[model samples]
Target: MSSSLAPGHPQVVVCKWSAELVRSMLDITPHVFVVLDEFDTAYMNPDWELLSRAERVYRISDFDSNEEISAVAADLILRRASIDHIVSFTEFSQFGAGYLEVLLGLTKDPMRHVAFRDKRLMKDRVRLAGVPTANWITLADPSREDDVAAVRETLSFPIVVKPVAGSGAIGTVKVETPDDLLPTLRGIEPDPHLKSDQLTAEEFIPGREYHVDALWSGDTPLYLIVSAYYRPRMSVLDTEPGADADATPPDGSYVVNAEDAPALYSRVTDLHRKVNRALGITGGATHLEVFERPDGELVFSEIATRMAGAWIGAVISECLGYEIHEAIARGVVTGKIPEVRPSRPYLGGLHLRPKGPGRITAIPDEEEMLAVDGVLRAQRLRSAGDSVDHAHPSEWCAFVVLGADTREEYEALARRVCDELRIEVEPAG
Candidate 1:
């Protein structure tokens, strides 16, 4: 076993408050140590299952700060004499946890983590490294006249305004025209997560969207899966001419097996390798989004140093015959590349979001959702009386994972599930 992972020493996870994470890492180590911020754990309630069973749990006030995270890690080491490893499974905590490792003499410089989370810094690094991405400019304050002029001069229309430090596409929007840019800028409220609500505008790259979920050890990916979205993810931000603004487009993606599309697999893998090199992520799960242009160019979109979300894990489990959620944590702790056992039938998933902002009156149960054909797993995220204010694509209330023999069938089945499944909401007054 690696020095970071001894047989019985506590495996430290600067937790994202995930039960699957605690259970998964426990498989590799006898004891699991979890760290959480008081802010998030209050809402999530870490008293459930595996988290409760952690050998030790540390609650900090400022999880967003690396110093605070490292302090907890340092304190844990003092009490335990030794710790197996340190890692985090969420976007918000990845930097903080990695910094902890650095402080413990396990990792190197921390600028790379900053580059991963800060949109402006991420694009700058990628661009300098000769990676293809949409041209972008950063505004410390979009409300300022100088910053607004810079955007007007530098980026063209239909650009996206994104939070410098954001996750799940929250506080991200598409500004369709130059005339609408100022109004769009004025309309956005301050985001607490971002540093001074800083923004980065990347001129939109037009293409079909895909997300690659991979486990990296050293310079290359040991295991990776590419899945293409059913439609461009940005469509969630789009407004239709005659429809209600909140009428969400059905969201889903089907995995593209390497055997079926060898060329695409090769290209994407190679591109992802370059991205990993440029960005400086050496280990654990990476969820990458990219754009494939009409002329067969792959443009880098964005990446999160965390696992893929929106039922990608369930899709992987259905096709690969294992729970990737826990397997990934297991892989990180034990330093073993996860075994890949590919199974038959093309698989995909649909994310069912609430219709609009409202107190959620009703959400379909697992049994009700499983009535749809070919569904392997149906998960309801919200219940009756649970309120939902769908501001971004990540505000989904349910997930449906399904499979079929052919790619066409997989696509058809995914749509069918979306059309049939319902999230009856009492619309916002």
Candidate 2:
């Protein structure tokens, strides 16, 4: 058993729904203060032996309500210990984390949390700062014709409509024609928890998409890495049938090649610095997405005030020699940002999603995937007879990490591994 909290140890409060990427944070600190949604307590029960090690835990029945979370956190702080920092890596927990930070007098500007969680607000902040971004409009009433006409006039075809505060590409739709606009809008089911006006319609910039992950101190970037997506996330999210039915599942490959794209790299880093200042991210990790147009123009997509999800941290830790969890912990604990950068030539990773909807009957052997050249790790997310949903990115079943000496070599290995891998599923009855 881990010993009791030692004096002078930073007492970090973590607000989370589950413990996916949270173990490292727990392991690295001696005094942990956990805040969990009451519903997640069941799923987290097995880890109670470990969670009990924390100095304290507060479970709120309504995690979405900032008032409830703040009240519970306030009572916890007053009754038990003084919290040095409030942190959350998950999207859903950001609201509560931010609320707690302000309620406990940790950060003076609470809008940073709002900007980080709300995509609509995030883009507006960047645009206000003179950063180039896709033209966008918020539609409180999807049924309003004036709003639809506004989108047609202000943006080009193939516009993107998504929840104002969504992640993992959930509820995101790409409409290519004005004819499909209203129908697509009607088809979207707004999250009941959000306001009626929380849907955003934005111009979809067609180009190669890339993400910049970095650790920051005020407006200064201590470390950053640029990675390219093998397939745009919308390719996986579009469920309109026809060609999409025959579409291949995403192998989830994102390549980090700073050496080959130094010019674009410089541009993205500069834009990221501007974004951080605009978003008021004084210190912590940030994930920003940008579109490299055909003519080489870079347009801002959106930014998150947390580490990149989708096992990005794992790839970075494996290839760059800096674990994201540790960086976040260190930043939160001591406010000291690590001075580190990508030390590798090229690093790539693949997340395997189900090719179609059905019950998974067979999957490629994990050992075989691991045996592939340049492959570092492989794991199956589902077993035989497990159901697979092909609609959302969250339903993807397997993940593999890789490293290589060059971008071309890494891309080839990633393609071969994805091609050879098989996930067999039987049609639903």
Which candidate number would show the highest lDDT if scored against the true structure? 1
TM-score of each: 0.88, 0.87
Question: Per-residue CA lDDT of candidate 1, range 1-429, in tens?
Answer: 223334545555546677667777766665677778876678876655666666677778756676677677677666643655666666667667767766666657667778878878888887777889998998888879988989988988889998888877788889988888899988887666655588889899898899998877766666788998866877853442112334323577888888888999899988887887888777788889999999999999888888777788788777667777666776676556556775546888788866567787777899988887788899998998877776777777888888788877776676566667767668666
Instruction: Encode model 2's per-residue lDDT on 289-336: one tens digit a residue.
Output: 899888888899988877887757778776557666777777656666
Q: What is the C-alpha lDDT of each candidate?
A: 0.76, 0.74
> Residue 212 in model 1: shift from native, Å?
0.4
Q: How does candidate 1 fare on TM-score? A: 0.88
Model 2 weakest lDDT span, ten residues long? 240-249
Error of 1 at 335 (Å): 3.3
Cα-based lDDT at residue 290, candidate 1: 92
